[model samples]
Target chain A: MSIALYFFAGLSAAAALGVLLFRQVLYAALSLLACLLSLAGLYIVMQAEYIAVTQIIIYAGGILVIILFGIMITSRLAGKPMQVSTQYPVIGSLLALLIFCALVLSQPAVTSHTSDFSTNHWQRAGRWLMTEYALAFETTGVLLLICLIGAAVTAIYQRES
Target chain B: MSPVLLYLSFLLFALGVSVVLTKRNAIVVLLGIELILSAAILNAIHFNQQFPDRMDGQLFALFIIVIAVCEAVVGMSIIIRVYRYYQTAVPDQINELNER
Candidate 1:
């Protein structure tokens, strides 16, 4: 588990760096895919198989595809494969380094307790959703519908008079 | 709760912030936002591992994923609209609101 955790963690960090350094928008998107997938693997190592699966399905599967489509369409509109440039690259990288250092230095020592009994995460999550979080669940559905409608309206190309 | 995973998320967050700060492309900026959201989700998952009995962290992570999905969709749509109007993808170049 430790080995897998370190591997995924390293992969995710590397991919995130690629997202920052890559000049091609396509390459950056691909880096994001790698980062997200590795993070999902880390989730599995943490013994949260349900969240891992959800991460893979929803994030890697759904969101990544949508992003790729957007990239493709936008590039087509520009009549060239999309490329990227940077502004204040040095300052931005330095700021990020400072932020990371701050996070590491300011964190308090952590203590974790392992549970003796293993629970069925899927069943338990479903039960909680249907019972304690029923209202939130329904509200989420409504929110998604609203987002779909809002996005469609915003993106629709209407000739502005 | 796990320090390793927590550190990893922190690293992701910092890198994401840099991408947003430096990148000129709106799409890349959107990707940076995704990275930031991912870091937040990782934090929730790490906390879930810490307290296995209380599934609040897991539940919050799930809901956060939904919110991120919405954000990405809307964000991309807005970027597309902006590109159409400005004929460029860089956020810095969109200066219609700026006094000439």
Candidate 2:
């Protein structure tokens, strides 16, 4: 488990860097896919099976398709492949390095815990969502509905005008 | 809360920051934001494991995923709109909002 965790973590980190450094938008999108998949692996290693499945479904399936559509639409409209220009590369790298150092320095000490991987993690999570987090769950549903309508309206309105 | 996980989260977050700061393409910036959100989700799940009796972190991470999907949809729509109006998706080249 530890070995798999570290391997996924390293893969995720590398893919994230690829997203940052890749020149073409499509390349970055592919890199983002790799990063998200690796993150799902990390979630599994952390024993969060429900979260892992959700990550793969929403991020890799839903969000990535949306992003790819966005890329396709823009590239079609522009009649060329999408390539982003870099701005303040040196300064951005320096700032990122500085923040990373701060984060590393502030990490909490690891505490040992007895391994107890719950097989019914999704069941427990669903119960919590329906009970303790019921209000938030309902709110998220409303929020998603509103966002869906708003996005559709915005896209249509933009195309018209 | 292994040290390796902590370091990995930091590394991913840093890469997200650099992507957001340096990339001119709006879609790529959205990708960077996704990376940052993933890192945050990882931290939440890690701590929740430390207190396994309560699954608050897992639930929170689930809600976050929902919100992130919404965010991506809305953000991409707006970016497409901007690309249509400005004829460019590069943030530096879009100055209509700044134009008086």
Candidate 3:
């Protein structure tokens, strides 16, 4: 299990790096899909089956599709690989590296305590979400509705000359 | 296989960010942002497993997914409108609003 956990973590990190280094938009999008799917797999490895499924459905299935469709609709595909300006490359890379190092250093040392990854815990999560977190859940729905209306208005409203 | 998988995910995330930062295409930038958000979600779930008593990480991941969808929709709409007015989707080319 430890080996599997480490493997998933490394895979996720690599995909994240791909996201940061890829030059082409389409390839980058594909890489993003790969990253999201891998994250879902990591969720499964972490014993969060519900999160894994949601990650797959909402991110890999839904959001990725919407982004791909947007790219298709925009028709801004590049003919050549985009170039990064060299003026601040060293500073930017150093900053990113520093942040990554900080994240790694901040992680708590792994302990020997092993959790019993079972179905009961999942049920507990469901109950808690429905009861304790219900308000937040409801608010999310409202937020989605508002986003939909706002998007429609923004897309449809024409500017007057 | 596990290490390989984790490395792969990291690579994807880095590539996505690069696209978002370097690409002139607005939609591509949005895609990159989505990739970054998913990376954060993955990290949360990983930590959640290590501490099962709290389901906060998973819940947060769920919320992040919802927000990502909302951002994509609204972002795409904004991009469409920008394209309609500017006749181009390249960020560099849409500088009419910039003050000289």
Candidate 4:
């Protein structure tokens, strides 16, 4: 399981990098799909099957399709690849490195938990969602609804204009 | 899993950031942003396994996914508008409003 997890992680990371490096928009989008799928795999490895499935369905299936549709409608394919400005590459890379280092160094080492995967994991999560964390869960749902409305309005308003 | 996978995830994330910062195309920059978000999600899940008592990490990942969806929708719409106005999606060429 650990080996598989590592493999999937590496695969995901590579695909993510590919998203950045690919010149074609479609290719970059496809690479994002790969990365998302691998993330789902990682979720499963963490014993979060629910999250894994949601990640696949929501991100890889729904959101990615939306992005691809946007690219299709916008006709970015016909345009030539853009050139990078030579002025800031070195500085940008250095800043990114510094941030990455800071993040890694600042994170405390995770303490290990010995609980094995059991059927009650979902039950516990459900209980928490309904009882203790119900408000937060409902708030997230409301946020999603707002975002959906906002996206729809943006799309429709643009079409009408 | 071994530490290599964790390192790889970090590397991918760094590459994505570089792409977003260096790329001149709006579409490509969005893709890079997506990549960076996924990397963060991956790390969260990885750490979640190390401490299974709390489902907070997984929940956070879920929220990130939702947020990413919203971001893509809005961002793509903006990109489309930019394309319509400028006839190009290149970041450098779309700077007409910023030019003095």
Predicted model with the maximum DockQ? 2
- Candidate 1 on B3-58: residue-level lDDT in tens? 88879889999999999999988889989999999999888878776677877787
Let me know the DockQ for model 2. 0.78
TM-score of each: 0.93, 0.94, 0.81, 0.84
Task: Give the DockQ-based CAPRI class for model 2.
Answer: medium
Chain A vs. true chain A, TM-score per model, equals: 0.90, 0.91, 0.82, 0.83
The residue pairs found clashing in candidate 2 are none
Q: Which residue segments of model 1 deviate by more than 4 Å?
A: A76-80, A116-118, A159-161
What do the candidate models score in CA lDDT, each in turn?
0.87, 0.87, 0.68, 0.73
C-alpha RMSD values across all candidates: 1.9, 1.9, 3.9, 3.0
Candidate 4 C-alpha RMSD relative to the actual structure: 3.0
Fnat of candidates, each listed:
0.73, 0.84, 0.51, 0.57
Better of 1 and 2 by DockQ: 2
Q: Indicate the worst ten consecutive residues by lDDT in candidate 2 chain A.
A: A110-119
Q: Model 1: what TM-score?
A: 0.93
Q: Give the Cα-based TM-score of candidate 2 against the true structure.
A: 0.94
Ranking by lDDT: 1, 2, 4, 3
Residue-wise C-alpha lDDT for candidate 1, range A1-161, written one tens digit per residue: 67888999999999999998888899999999999999899877776677789889998999889889888877745666688999998999999999999999997666666554466778888898899999999999999999999999999999989
TM-score between model 4 and native: 0.84
> For residue A28, what is the lDDT in candidate 3?
65
